[model samples]
Every structure is written in structure tokens, then in C-alpha cells.
Target: MTASSWLLVAFPALGALILLLAGKRAKAWGHLLGCATVTLAFVYGVILFFAADTKSTVDTKLFSWIPVSALQVDFGLRIDALSLTFVLLITGVGMLIHFYSIGYMENDEGRYRFFAYLNLFVASMLVLVLGNSFVTLYLGWEGVGLASYLLIGWYQGRNSAATAAKKAFLMNRVGDVGLALAIFIMFKYSGSTGYAQVFDAVAAGKFPPAAITAMAILLLLGACGKSGQFPLQAWLPDAMEGPTPVSALIHAATMVTAGVYLVARSREIFNATEDGRLIVTLVGTVTLLLGCVVGCAYDDIKKVLAYSTVSQIGYMMLAVGLGPVAYALGIMHLVAHGFFKAGLFLGAGSVMHGMNDEVDMRKFGGLRRKMPITYVTFGLGYLALIGIPPLSGFFTKDAIIEAALGQGGWRGWVMGGAALLGAGLTAFYMTRLMVMTFHGKERWKDLKSEDGRDFHPHESKPIMWVPMAILAVGSIGAGAFFALGHRFTEWLAPSVGETVEAHHLPVEAWVISVAAVVISLLGVLIAWLVFRRDVPVERPERVSFVTKAARKDLYGNALNEAVVARPGTWLARALVYVDNRGVDGAVNGLAAALGGGSGRLRRLQTGFVRSYALSMLGGTFLLLVALLLVRFS
Candidate 1:
């Protein structure tokens, strides 16, 4: 089993390498390799989950990675319930996405490169979850960031894709700095960066209040970057430039969740610091509202989902902010969101595939008749996302809300209210999307020529539908894992013993559950009333100011341009000017001065015979005078 655990990391990486070597000539082989590798990884995750001892961390040291007098690090794997859960998600959901990519990316010329990056992403994510030490984890962390940049810019010919990829990379680099600083602080304070050792030291309360606050804040910054929170969130929506499968994997299942996982893994430090917890809660609340607002305005199908990813990440952050019970709530929401969100992205892909690459929902209408399977599957996922009753999102979302309300005070209430409002907005935008894309009159007049030959949109192939169906089932039933909450808590008890009690709540859990359902329904009603009315759709110029604001994402992008981009560009230009004039000019002046002096010295070397004789006579006279003076002395 220990050997098998290593296989989990090796398989996808091996697959990626093979695909890279084979390149475009082996496109089919690339997909096959990617699917096979992740499938084996998912099976290994299932085996490890059941076989490993749940009560403690199962650390398997393969070798010593770093050895120093002051610091020692080992290459090892950690297979606890928490790690196992994420492993299953990354490999299992990742494999499904890989299979879906075969059909979705079939028309593209660079299919092999696409699958190669996907395989690499899977391998890096597994390394991230399985790593037992901070060093190993950071390796995986940066690896995923690299892969994200590569995949997002896969369509390098498109300027938007290249720009989006750069944005994602640069933003994540900011978070990476915070994470690196936190790791250093942990090693300095706790004497080790191993999860078990550092956590144990933290639980023992060896660090001061200030140190604890700094560590938590730094880790939170990393989380903010990876999870798309607050100011750092500007990159995610632009990340819609990538292929749908890439978006589904990075935004939904794997990379973004790294932040939530980091905070949860470091719960001990956070639980000890009030300021830290407050920061987490505040950031989460802000991101949730921001994402929801922006999501409501976008008509582009993938951009809407991208913003929703930001919003859902906020919900998870809220769970972490609430403390211990929120951790489980966050994890539960994480699992459920993974299913529905991935399903939603793939469904969008199916629509794009059927419409011959059309993604603007405004350009689509009456697609339900043509793409019935996609409509049904996507609708199911959307319901789950909106927190509709009996779906996976409802149960998990309510738990987080309950934890927030029960946790006490005005902050909790404010965050809880914001979360609920976000939920309502989620339904509104998603419904708007569904109606405009699938429920209206046919918008595409080019579907047929003037002769009126059939040019109808067709259903997606079985490969695409299979993953959507699997994810749809998970979206409906994933909330059942909440029933095993006690078992999960027990398994993680040793690592989080002291803070585990912080998760326990005595309030009426059903109250929040009921409220969430009612609110979701209300959102659906509002969407229907506004978008599904008999009145014709108004032009943008004719709409109200508020509607226009919502349509333009509340001018969020404009705000970002003003606040982030303008200043950054000005600063960069200023530095360039200073370097050219101040630094380079100074160095060039020094070189010119030395050359001038050397030129004067060169004149004395005149090669003429008369000049040489005069110099020799002068030299002889000087030598004779010096000898006479020395002799007299």
C-alpha cells in the first residue's frame, strides 16, 4: 500500500512525460495515457482511504530530500482522511475531465499538448495533497501554478489567452511569496516544517501572539491568491480564456482549493488568534459578495462560471473563518461544489461543441430542443449549485450559514447575510443564463442557408455525456458525506484535537437548511419573473441604471484598471527611465572617461624614430641625475 501511494504521484507525471515526447503525432495516445494514469490514481486513492489508519497521520518517508545542521527535510507522503478526500477528488474528477477532453478538444490541432498539461496538472495536484512536509507541498504548489499558466495560454495565438495566462501567473506569485514567508516563519518558530511537527508545536503554544498572527495572515494571503479572494481575484474571470476542461479542473476541482486546504491544515494557528480568524471571515465575506456581483453581469457563459468559482471559494473561506465546525463545513462544501461546478463547466462545453464554438449565451436560444441531454444535465448541476432542496449544495451551504449565525455577534450576521444574498444572486444569474441560452426563441439565423437546408444543433457524443452524467450523480448525492461527519472528525482528531471542539454547534441546524432552500427558490422566482416574461428583451441603452450596472459587472474591471493597472504601468515606466538615464548613463560616462585618458597615454608611444631618440635622451638624463644624487647622499 505504501508503494502504491507513491504510484499515485508517479502515474500522472509519467503520463505527462510520455505525451510531451510524443507530441501532436500521438494525440489519441495522449488522451489514453492521461485517462489511464488518473484512473489508476483514483483507484489508489480509494484503496488508501479505506486501508489507512484514520486515527493518525500515515507518513511514509521515501528518502531524505534535504539535510542540513539547522534544517532537515524528508520526501514523504501523508495519507490521512483529509488528504485522502482531496486525493479522491483530484484524481477521480480529473480523470473524468480528461475523458471529456477527448471529445471537446478533438477538433483542435494541439490536442496532445492540451492532454499533456492536463496530466501534469493531475500529477502536481496529487503531489500537493500527498506531501507530508511544507517543502514537498510547495514544490507541488508551484508546479500547479506553472501548469495553470501553460494550459491557460494553450491558445497562444489569441491575445486574450496569453494575457489571461500572465494574469493568473503573476497573481499567484504574490500568494506564493506569502506562503514562502509563512514556511520560513514556521521553521524558525517551530523548528520543523513537517505537518505533524509544526502542528504539534503550534498546539503546544510555543509561539507568541504576534508570531501566530503573522503566520496566519501570511498563510491567508497565499490562500487568497490561490482561492481567488479579494483584490487578488481579478485573474480568475479572465482565466476563462482556457479550454473548458482546463477551467473545470483548475477552477473547480483542484488548484483553487489549495488555499482552503492550507487554512484548514493550519487550523491550530488560526484558532489561537482572534485577529487571524476575523481577517479570514472578513476576506471571505468580501470575496463572496464581489464574485456574486460580478457573476451577475457577465453574459459570456464561461466568465459567469468563473466568477461563480470565486463566489463558491468565498463560501469555503467563510467556513474556515468560522473556525472548527466551519472547517468540516468548508470541506463538505468543497466536495459538493467540485461535482456541480465541474458538471456545469462541461455542460457549457457541450453547448459550445454543439453550436460550433458559440459561447455567448445571448447568441443562443431554443437549444433545449436540440441539446436535450446537455440541458437536463446542466440544469441539474445548476439546481445543486443554487442550493435547491435535496441537492448536494443545499446541505453543505446551510451548514456553513448555520455555523456563522450560531458563532455569534454582528460580524457573523453580516457575513451570513452576505452569503445568503450571494446565493440569491447565484440563482438569478444562472437562471438568466439558462433562459437566454436554452429557453428562448431561436437566436441564430445562420443555422440554415437561404435555401433552408437543415442546420440544427446536435447533441454531444457519448464521451462528453458520460462524465457529465457521473458528475451529475455526485452533485446530487455528495452531501451524504455530511452524515459521516463524526467519523471524519474522529479520523482528523489527533491532528486537530484542541480546535475540534470549536466546530461543535448546538443550534437548530434545520433552520438554516430551510432558509437556504426558501431563498434559492425565491431567487429562481425572481429570475423567472424578470427574464422569462412575455416582454421583449430591451437594448442596453434602454435598461435602468441598476440593470446596466449589473450587466457591466458593476464596473469591476474598470475599477481594477484604475486601481491596479494604471499605477503599475506608471511605476514600470518610471523605473525604465531611471535605469536608462541614471544607471546606464553613469556606467557609460565612466567608461568614456577611462577611454579618453588611455587615448592621451597612447600619444606618448609615437612610433617615429626621432620621437624615440628624444625620449631615450630625456630618460638617460633623468637616470644620470638620480644616480649622482644618490652617490652624493
Candidate 2:
């Protein structure tokens, strides 16, 4: 909370540097070091959490980073309730994942290297949340991106992993463009990217509505990229190609949450315009539906979870985008999601570990008896995820739904219905996942490991299951605790700004809450009936149009290729042609003409004295003839 709070990031960053630099020498001790750094960070984060006041914000200038003629960007940290909340989530979840990784990745030769990347990511994310200026935030933003690329492609031996990494990097680049432009816009109008200065300027009515709206849209584009919203969202599910721990920490818990944090952090600019919030709501609605449908088609355990993550982020976006009453609701969901999602992912990893590192849920069955701890933890997480009453998801997700419906008129009906439907689909897909993975006939009995040995499914060790258990506890309690007296919303107000009061919903609060529970249970019951006892090992070729489309990522890739990627390719080719034919041709043609002329002119410079004398006599005769003609004329 004081000057020393900088060490929260410094510790992990230094740990990563030393481990990477020491190479083989540090390999044996590197995992321990990595865990220690994050643990220390979490400790400091907790300390700062208690020390930080809900009513105040502090800005600490570390040093002058950029001092130019028209701009000054200082490297400083912003310590406030909102940033602290994110910091705690990042470091706390990061620590648990790091510990879990020690057990899961123990045998890999690159275990130390994995730890290094993990530590680096923690440090980068910390900086991103704590930064006081846009430039500083961007520095951390890019750092997180680079680390994600490295982690997601951890299995470099596989072409798919490499491709997935590139996809993530490139798609994020598409989003990063929006974030960069937003920053430029802020700087252009306000002459500063410092949070306090720009926000103050905005509050003072300095910028016009159009300009503020533009900034909001651009920032939302950036959010869509990082948070895995529509159009820019195809990358996040693909990010599962990395280690499961990476999925738990980066994709599920920390890094993907960056977009929500960004929007919440810059709420002032967004508050200036209604269009900005509406756009956010639209993107969230579409993405949640997209993720929900896609999730139903994936048999890969991790891919299902990946798509689920996409869906959940959509909910968060929808909540925040609703504006005012929903900002706190969005963050509340985000924090609760951090717990259950991490637990679910780690539980998935445990499932994989037991079945010889397999990811196909169709090949798994009756794992409940074998992995008790994992089953219990995953079950709690599942309940939380389904938004069952009293669990985290219920309290947080219900608030968003109620708020959306509270909008009234057609917008409320449309947005609220989308959220409500997404909830049912969420339950349906997740329940389907649970049934296929845990309750069905033992499909693994007939399968063999990649090494051709009989599969013997078993539970992970204490180190792994312990963290999941803790997270499961969080999954159960976090939402209820935050929902109590709206404690979390009040805590975050000083930093995230106040919510405007909105009209109540047409339905009663109890009715809305009851409807959510009923819808979720219906989905679960249907899935139980459909998938509890039977599953197909081979995927069906002929199915419904919805199935086919969902299996193809709802044709998002095709759309991108048709709409964005192909057009981009054509534009690039056109630019290349211009460079070659127009620009280069002009220079090349002039050079060729000069060369040819010089070659022809060289023939006239013969160096013979006799030839020169003859030429001189011929010249003298010609001169006399000219003089005589001139005289006569």
C-alpha cells in the first residue's frame, strides 16, 4: 500500500529473469522459486487490500517515463479499491495455479521454464492493474500478451499448438489496435493519458459527446479482444492448447479478465454516452449466445471449458455494459468467476492426469469413484457455474439478469431474454459436460493410452487437489459474501464510480431469481436424461444444422475470413502491387534510361589524335561554308 508495494510485481519479475537466465543451473529449484514469488505477492496483495481505503485513491509516481514536447507519461502506480480487488484476484489465483502446476508438471523437462513464464505473467498482470497511466498500462498489456503467446504454445512440438498461439496473438493484435487508438484519442483530446487527469477532464465536460463515444467504442473493441467477445473472440478457446494450468490462470481467471478491468477502470468516459454502453451490451449478448451454442458441440473436455469461459466473459461484459447499477454486478461476477473457473479448470487437469493426459470427455466415465477430491471440487464448481441458489454464480449472474430486465421496454426484454437463455444453455452444456465426463458408463475401460498401455484412472496428489478444494470453497462462498449488504459494490465505488438508479423490473425480484433457478435445473435435468448412461465415441457426421454450425465454431472463422481476413489480404496485396508497379517502377525506369543513354554516349568519346585532326579539318571547312552563305544571304 506504500512505496514498497512496487515489489509485488518486482518479486515475480525478478524470479522469472533469474530462472530464465540460470537455465539448467536453476532448473531443479525454479518451480519452488516461482511459487514463492507469487505467494509473496499474494501476501502483499492481502496486506494492501486491508490497508487500502474504500473512500480514497492514491497515485504514486515511480519516475518520469516519457517526457516529450507535447506529452509526459510517468511511470506510476494507482492503488485503489478496484485495482486492489483485481490485484488480489490475479496474484491469489496465480499462486494457487502455480502450486498446482508443481505437481502436474513435475516430470516435464521444461517444468522450470513453465514456471518462469507463469511468474512473468503474474508480474505483467499486476503492472497492468496497478498502472496509473495509459502508457504504463499498455506496457503491461503488451507484456501479458507476449507471455500468453509463449504459454499457449508451450507444446511447440505440435503444429496445432503453434497455430493456436499465432491465432491468439494475431486476433489480440486486432483488438490491441482498438486499445491503442483509444489511448491516442484520449491523448489527442485531453493532452494526457493519466487516469485522474483524463477522467477529471471528462467529468468537467471538456470533450464532446461524439469524441467520448468514439473513445468508448474503441475501448470496447480492445475489451472484446482481451475478454474474448464476439468478432475478436475466436482466440480464447483456442488458447486451451497450452497447459491446463495456463487455461486455469490466464484464460479462465486472470488475463482474460483484463477487458472487464479496463472498462471498469475507464467507466467515466463510457458514462458520457449511451451508445457506448448499448454497443457493449450487443457484443456481450451475441458472444454469450455464440459461446453457448459452440460449447454444446465440443467433446474435448478442455474445449468445452474454453467455450464456457467465452460465455462467462460475455455475461461479465453484458453486466458492465448495462452501465451504472450493473458495473458492480459485473465485477462481482468477475471475482466469483475467478474462483469457480479456476477450480473447474484445475479439476479438468486432474481428470486429464488420471486418464493418461486425455482430453476427450467421451472417453471418460464414472471418474467420481476414482477421483473423490476432484469430483467434489469440480461438483462445487459446477454448481456455482450453473448459478444454483446461494452459490457464487447465482448471486452475481442473477443481478445482471435482473438489471438487464429492469431496463424495461424492448431493450430490456431483448437483453434480459438473451441473458436468461444464455443461463439455460450454460446449464445445459455444462451439465452435459459433467454427465459425459463423470456419470456415464466407463468408456475408458476399452481405451488405451498413447503408449498402448491399459488406462488406469487415478486421482491427483494432495498438492494439486488441495488448491482446488480451497477454490471450491471460494466458489461456494464468494458470491453470497459479496452479495451480503452489497459489500463488494460499496467497496469498489470509490474507484469504479457510482451507478445511476434505474427503474425496477416488471417481474418481482423473487420471481426473477426463481425463474433463473428453474431454467438452470431444467437444462441439467434434460442433459441428465439425454447423456447420463450413453455416449458415442465416434462423432456423428450427419446431424442438425445447429450441430453442424456449432461444431464449426458457428462459422466464425469463415466469417472472419470472408469479412475481415480476406479483405485484409486483398488490401495487403494491393499495397504490394502499388509498391512494385507504381513506386518501384518509377525509380527503376529512370535508372534504366540513364544506364542506356550513358552506354550510347560512351561511343562518341573515341581517343585517337589522327581522328581528332581529321575532325578539326572537317569542322574548319564547314565553318567557311557557313560564313560564305551568311554573307550571301
Candidate 3:
């Protein structure tokens, strides 16, 4: 029965292969088949999740993927707490998103292809999590990257979608390089890429601190790229160019957090290196703020939600970065965040469906009544996201905050303050989104679509709202279920390592928790009060500097262009110039000199017998003169 776990990936991969090869011939039923693949995977994942316990780990080899001298990489699936958790999340949320897309993309001509791509995305993520070696993981990692590029650019005719897809692919490539290099480092140092072997080697102190830190940082780079952390995060918001269900599937529940999974899974490397752990903490702290500030300035509902995903993922990263102390917390937040964020994205999709696909929240007002189902489900997700009590966010996020403050010094203060600040900003932006989108004055009296059809926003169909409703329930109940007795964290202990309570807390846990709640409520209150009605749908030219900067993603794009992109471009040009002028110049110059000398020397090949005789006479006369001079001397 456990061996049947291979079916988890096979089902979806086969679905993708069939739909892709069938092309237009299978359009009508392919979408249904695609949905079935993931549904079956989810069912299998559930079975595995329950059957497996803390110590239950099964590594089943399918075939020998790479078997070289002293280097063996197997195409193996690891069934354990860590991989199984991701499998369930990927497949379960995936199945719901697939079902929802049936309605979301019903009118699109390429709906079958879209489902096929989505299935492949899930299959690839499962491969990534279940992989037994770094090589196997890289295989799945690249697969997910390819599948996502396809999904993000599903609207082949749209230039924005095409550009977004390219951006996603290029940015992710940067991370893939990091992952590849890290694997190389592991093989160089440990002589094996298998997780158990690498972990054992490291535990036996086979590697130096520098090597550990280098590998950790390299892996961090990969995480940053996939998870949309700083420096490599600019592409995520633009990912909204894809369909809403894609946003829900890839951004929220699955692909974006592959980095988190990588870090969490590679916990031993990070734990052994102090600077590496702190670096992870710093990246998470900074990116969370970047995400929050950016989220507040976006009027595009999808972009706002996109930034929200960025910020939430930061919380997870921060938790994992807390080293062994909060690995479970990170996983907990990740699971809870998955529920609420997916619901939020799907709910946003519902809003788009009702409002003729208009994304600007300023154009959406009094929609709470018009789209009651969306409002209710989205509202629950909203509360959960903002960390309201009894919701998933509160349970999972508060644990992270409390853990941060528990670090017991200025370190705790700095990281905790950053987390708290991000939380407040999150609430503010999300409340602004809710108010402007659902509770403000009617702003759609003259709204029109691209086709010039008048917009009369209405509720989404049952197919769409049903999934949103289910996810909403998860967002509501997941926190309590997971956090009540520390059940989820305890369950995750065998994999992430047991989290001993942080006894070195700088402040009382209750005090920190209270501040978090108050700060969140404060943000929510101010946003609702400030933006209860009449938002400017059109871009304002005279906004303040913060708004301006944030609207441009806090000049993150410009900064990257100046610091990374521009410098990199100039360096590439310089390298090309040097290669052509310095290296190639020498070779070409030598070749030219040889050619010129040969051309002049070739003139001496005058083939006439008279020329030959004249040369011989000159040589004979010079020889006699030299002979006479030598004799006289």
C-alpha cells in the first residue's frame, strides 16, 4: 500500500502528458481528467498522511536516475512527515483549485491546456518534496519552474502574460543556480547527495563551518528566488498576470513556498552555521516589511493579495530562521497561511468574476451585498489573515511572534519588532482592501469591460464559491485544530525536530501576544476609518513620497536595475568586449600577422627560371667577395 504512493505523482504527470499530446482533440473532457488526477493524488496523500506517524519514513526507489562511478542518484520518493505534509497541501489545495478553475476558465478556449499545466505544476511540486536526493529535487524544481511558466502565460496572446512568464522564468533561474551550486557543494564535501547520508556526514562533523555556511547561504538564495524573498521578489506581484486560480494554486498553496520547504528540510545545514541562521532571519525580517509596505499602496486587488502572500511567506521564513527553536512554528504558519491565502486568492477571483474582471479595488464598492458569498468567505479569510483570534492566522502567527520575542535580548527586540510592524501593516492593507472593495459607496455605476459591456457585478457561480467556502472553513478552524494542544507542531516534531519551549524570552508571552493583537486591530481600524468610501480608481499624480515609492514597490525595481540589473548588464558587455578585444584580439592579431608575412613571402615564389638564375648569380658573387676578404685578412 505504501509503495502505491508513487501514484501520487504518476496520476498528475500522466494527466498532463495526455492533455498536452491530445491537443485540441481532447479539449472537451481533458479538463475533467486533469481534475481527476489531482483529486486522486489528494485522496492518496490523505491516506498516507493518516497512516504515517512520527517515526514512519519510507524511501522507495523507482529507478536509478544517475548511477556513475562513486556518484549514485536515485529516482526515489520519500514518504515521511515533512514530504507527506507538502504532498497533502499541494494535492489537496490543488484539487480544490482545479475544481474552481472549471468555472473560472470556463469561457477560455485554452481551458484544457490550462488544467494540464496546473496538474503538471502539482506533480512537479510533489516530486520536489518526495525526492530522495538533491538531483531528484532539482529535477522536480526545474519541472515546477517550467510548468509554472506555462500556467502564468496561459493567455498566449497577451503581451503582459508573456512578459510575466518570462520574468518568472528568468528570476527563478537565478534561484535554480543557487540550488544547483548548493548540491554541487554537498557532493564536493559530503561525497553523497542523499538526505540521510548528507545529514549523517554533517552530524559527524565531516564539513567545516565555512562549508556549512556557504551551503546554507546558497540554499537560502534558492529559497529567496522560489519563495519570492528580497532581491528576487519583484516578479511575484506581476505573477498576477496569470489567471486567479493559478495565483491561488502556485503563489499561495504550493510553488512559492518550495524555498521554505527546502530550508526547513535542510535544517541541519542551517543549524550548524550561526551566521547562516541569522542571515535567514534578516532576509525574512526585511522582506516582510518590503511586502507590507508594497501591499498597502496597491489598488489592484490581486496585486494587494500578491504582496500579502509575500509578507505571509516572510513570516514562515522568519520562523524557520529562528533555527531549531521555531522550525515547527514556521511549518505551522506555512500550513495555516496556505489555507487563508488560498481562500483569499480564490475569493479575489470570485470578486473579479462578478465585476467583469476589474482588479482595481477602488472600482469595487457595495459589493458586500452584490457578492454575498464572496464577501462572507473572503471576509472569513480576511479575518484569518489579519490574525484575528480563533482563526488560523492568529494561532500560527502569534506563535512566531512570541518565539521571536522569546529570543531574550536586543536580538529578540529587533526581530520581534520587525514581525510586529509587518503584522500591523498587513492588517492595514488588508482592511483597506476589504473596505474599498466591499463596504464603500457604490463606485461602479458606469463601469465597463474591455468589450464595452456594462458591468453589473454579481455573485460567482456555485462551482467557484464552493471551494472558497471550504477554504474559508479551513482558515477558520485550522488554527485551533493545530495550535490547541500543540498537536500539529507535535506531529511535525519528528521531521522538523522537537521545539523546546523558549524559556529565554525577553518579555512575557502574553505581553507580546497582546501587542500583536492590538497592533493588528489598530491597523485594521485606521484603514477602515480612512478608506470607508470614495477611493480614487484612477492613479493619483500628487500622492506623498511613501505612497509614490511603495506604488513603485519602494523603488525595489529601480534599485535592482541600478544595483543588480544595470551592473550585471554592463559587466556582461565588458566581458564580451574583453573577450573580443583582449583574448580574441591576440589570436586574430597573430593570425593576421601570419597571413601578412605569408603574403609577402609568397611573392618570393616568382616561378620563372630567369629569376632563379639571377638569385643564384647574386649569391655566387657575394660568396666570392666574402672569400677574398677572409683570405686578405
Top TM-score hit: 2
- How accurate locally, in lDDT, is each candidate? 0.84, 0.90, 0.89
- Model 1, 1-633: lDDT tens digits are 764689898989998998899887776577787888889888888887788776677899999989898799999998777888788899889989999999998888888888889989989988888899888999999999999999999889999999999989998998999999999999998898998888788888878889999999999999988888886888888888999899999877789999999888788889889899989989998898888877777778999998899999999998888776567778878988899999999999998877766667766778899999999889989988998867888877876777777665687578778887888888888888888888867776445422454345789999999999999989877756555456544555555442343322335667666777778788888888876643233345676777688676667667767887788899999999999888998998899899999999999998899999999999999999999999999
Ranking by TM-score: 2, 3, 1
The order of the candidates by lDDT, greatest first, is: 2, 3, 1
Predicted structure 1: lDDT: 0.84
After best superposition, candidate 1 residue 173: deviation in angstroms? 1.1
lDDT digits (tens) for residues 227-290 of candidate 3: 9999889989988999999999877677897999999999989989989989998899899999
**Of models 1 and 3, which has the larger TM-score?**
3
Off by over 4 Å in 1: 445-455, 481-508, 534-539, 542-565, 604-633
Better of 1 and 2 by TM-score: 2
lDDT tens digits by residue: candidate 2, 163-269: 99999888888889999998998888889999999998899888889989999999998888888899888888889999999999986556789999898888888
Error of 1 at 616 (Å): 13
Per-candidate Cα RMSD to the true structure, in Å, reads: 4.2, 1.9, 1.8
- Candidate 2 Cα outliers beyond 4 Å, as residue runs: 499-502, 613-633
**Estimated TM-score per prediction?**
0.90, 0.97, 0.96
